[model samples]
Target: MSVKSYRQALNEALHQEMARDPHVIVIGEDIAGGAGASGQQDAWGGAFGVTKGLLGAFGPARVRDTPISESAFVGAAVGAAATGLRPVAEIMFVDFLGVCFDQIFNQAAKFRYMFGGKAVTPFVLRATFGAGTRSASQHSQALYPIFTHIPGLKVVIPSSPYDAKGLLTQAIRDNDPVIFLENKLLYDTVGEVPDGPYVIPFGEANILREGSDVTIIAFGRMVHIAMDAANALAKEGIDCTVIDPRTTSPLDEDTILESAEETGRVVIVDEANPRCGMAADVSSIIAEKAFGALKAPIMKVTAPHTPVPYAPNLEAAYLPDATRVAAAARAAFTYGK
Candidate 1:
């Protein structure tokens, strides 16, 4: 095991996968910087430098850069995947999905089902998401819920470097279209990761902290936030279990229900807007299936239903933090008691 940053983990995953499978290729804007310029190549390595060394290792044929048009390249990725290439296309930011929604939600996502189960679109759409860099409203939205809502797309959000490496490997190997959303703020966060390639199975909820008082279900970057809250809650004799549903699409409802039933209280923390977000969806699942087990009402701590603010203070307020999560857990623990 080695301690690595989330960005390094993702970069290593892409490198390992490309080396293992000849069919695996990468396509995105500035993925291989200095496409035709006089300067050095592989300059940008993507907007976050996650795809940096790939161009040198894989060469231009596999690590191809594309125009800024999301529709054309994303559509091309869909075509390439249908033609037997495992393409990992980077979208720069999740908010840019608006320009190429049809290619993802309609084309790549529906190929297998629409073709009588004969098509295998082994495509991974990697995008930087979440609000912490203060990239403003257009670039910082946590839009994982939008992809999670779609049927044919598999969504994976890893909160740590270890999960990022394992889950990206799985996403590349899977025979279905996968939306791999990476929280921009977590790119620099470091965690222990295996040296060689590994895969973390989807739909498995990882229990970060086991507790008896309440259950906290968090996704992506919010997982760390939940952990912070759980640690703080532990001091006040209110132990809490934090579950990270690694893959949002094939959600680990069983683990969620089990924890909810055991704790008899739940506080869902999501970075996305409250309406129709993962927090609401998870709350509904617990309310419907584990209603009798619940001792207190389910509390949801999420971002407001508004665009991410540009100002640092407003952005901080817009995003759910450890303080809010701890408060929600306290509320759940004290309800009706």
Candidate 2:
């Protein structure tokens, strides 16, 4: 198989899904640019050019462009999903979820439960998220927990190129609405992805490295950081098993709890805030379900409970890095005093 970047893998997934299902359609701003302008059509092909050749391949009906209104387009996407089509809408920045939360949380997320499991919204909302890029508070935010708290929606935070493609395909095909958060920094990160269509089940936690010393649970880009720490920790004889729970909503709590029980220690790395975040949620799970398997108090490496800062230094500090993840792992490994 060819080595492809995370961004390319996602693009390929969209291309494959669109080709496979006539019901699967993409809608968002400038998905295929120059709709009414004098310039050539399909000019932009998405803000990051992920949907570049889709317009040429599928034509305008499938690869659609919408106005700069998150509510209108996102609402329309939810409606279309409820009707029959599996729509993949690009919200640009997840920070823009503010304008469309009503449609997402109120409508799409609650439809199945509200309708007594009669309605199925097979929709995927792909949006760029996380700090870095210096886009500031308004643009950069790792807001996964908010969606995770919702019952009827599935939240996917894929850390690698392979996961990106597989999880995205699953999201498009699944009966529930999914919020697929792609880190901007990870767009260029390269990895091997299957050429053919494949699916990664939501509740399965992938153990990146199996170790007995400590278990590190992470999601999205934080998984990479935890894996980095595990690689370095292995040198010092502190082996860490890194688990990426691909989808936060379906959560794979069984796998996480089982790993925690086996290792007797856990370090959770989350890119979001400390309070009421995924780190806290996992820590609580380990505490309740596998409390007897505690070799050390659970450690959480996460951003502070504050808005993402504008400055590069603060932003870097705000985001959990490999160094921070390593320190947390060290704490868990060295605990017992």
Candidate 3:
């Protein structure tokens, strides 16, 4: 294993997977670069450069550049997956999914069940999410909860480079439509990742830290914020456990319930709006199953039920941070004591 940024890890995963399986193909806007725009293969590499070097290795047939149309290309990817190829379609930003969501939720997500288990759509829809860099409301939003709400779509949100590479490999291999979201703030963060491709199974939560006072569950870049909160709380005598539910669809309810029962107080942190979001979903799960072990009402630290703001200060305030997470965890930690 070697240290790699989240972008490098994602690039490596695409390289390894395409080489291993000829059926794997990539279709996205400006992914393979384009004419008169840096003018060569792997030049642009999508909006964030995660798909860099794919064109040089896989060629045009496998690494394709589609027109600037989310609906057309995403629909094409779904159709391609249904026919035979395993297509990894990149949607630049998750906000653009509104244009092609039916293709994802209706067509790609329903093939296998509609065909009575004979059909398989091995499609991986990769998109960048989260609020940072002042992309404004149109570009920065956490929409994983909507994908998770869908019945057949498998949702993945990796918090680190190690998790990104392994979980992405797993998505490419899995025989179902997968929505893999990469947080915009996490692409530059570096971590140790294996050189060879690896797969981390779905429904497995990564317990970043173990403590007894309270359990903090988070998603995507929020996981790091939760980790920071845990470390800070440890100094104040409020030990905490941080869990990252890697795939929200096949959510590791077992791990979450076990941790909630063990601590008897739970705090869920989500970057999305609190209404009908991951925070609410997880809070409901804990309340429904682990209520008997609870020492206090379950707490959810999430963004306000509004769109992400454009101003830097408001944007910062709109997203959940370590201080807020620590505050929530501390509240839960000392509720009765």
lDDT of 1 by residue, 1-337 (tens): 9999999999999999999999999999989753333366636789888998777677889988888999999989989999999999999998998989999999998999999999999999999999989799999998889999999999999999999999999999999999999999999999999999999998988999899999999999999999999999998999999999999999999999999999999999999998999999999999999999999999999999999999999998999999999999999999998
Q: After superposition, how far is residue 223 of candidate 1 from its true place, in Å?
A: 0.8
TM-score of 2: 0.97
Per-candidate local distance difference test: 0.93, 0.91, 0.92
Instruction: Give one digit per residue, the lDDT tens place, for model 3 in 1-337.
Output: 9999999999999999999999999999989853233455536878889888788777889988988999999999999999999999999999999999799999999999999999999999999998977999899999999999998899999999999999999999999999999999899999999999899999999999999999999999999999999999999998899999999999999999999999999999999988999999999999999999999889899999888899999999898999999988888888988
Q: Candidate 2 residues 1-337, lDDT tens each?
A: 7899998899899989999999999999988843332367636878876777788778889888998999999999999999999999998899999888989999999999989999999989999899889999988999999999988889999999999999999999999999999998899999999899999999888999999999999988888889889999999999989999988998999999999999998999988988889999999988999999899999999999999999989988888998988998898899984
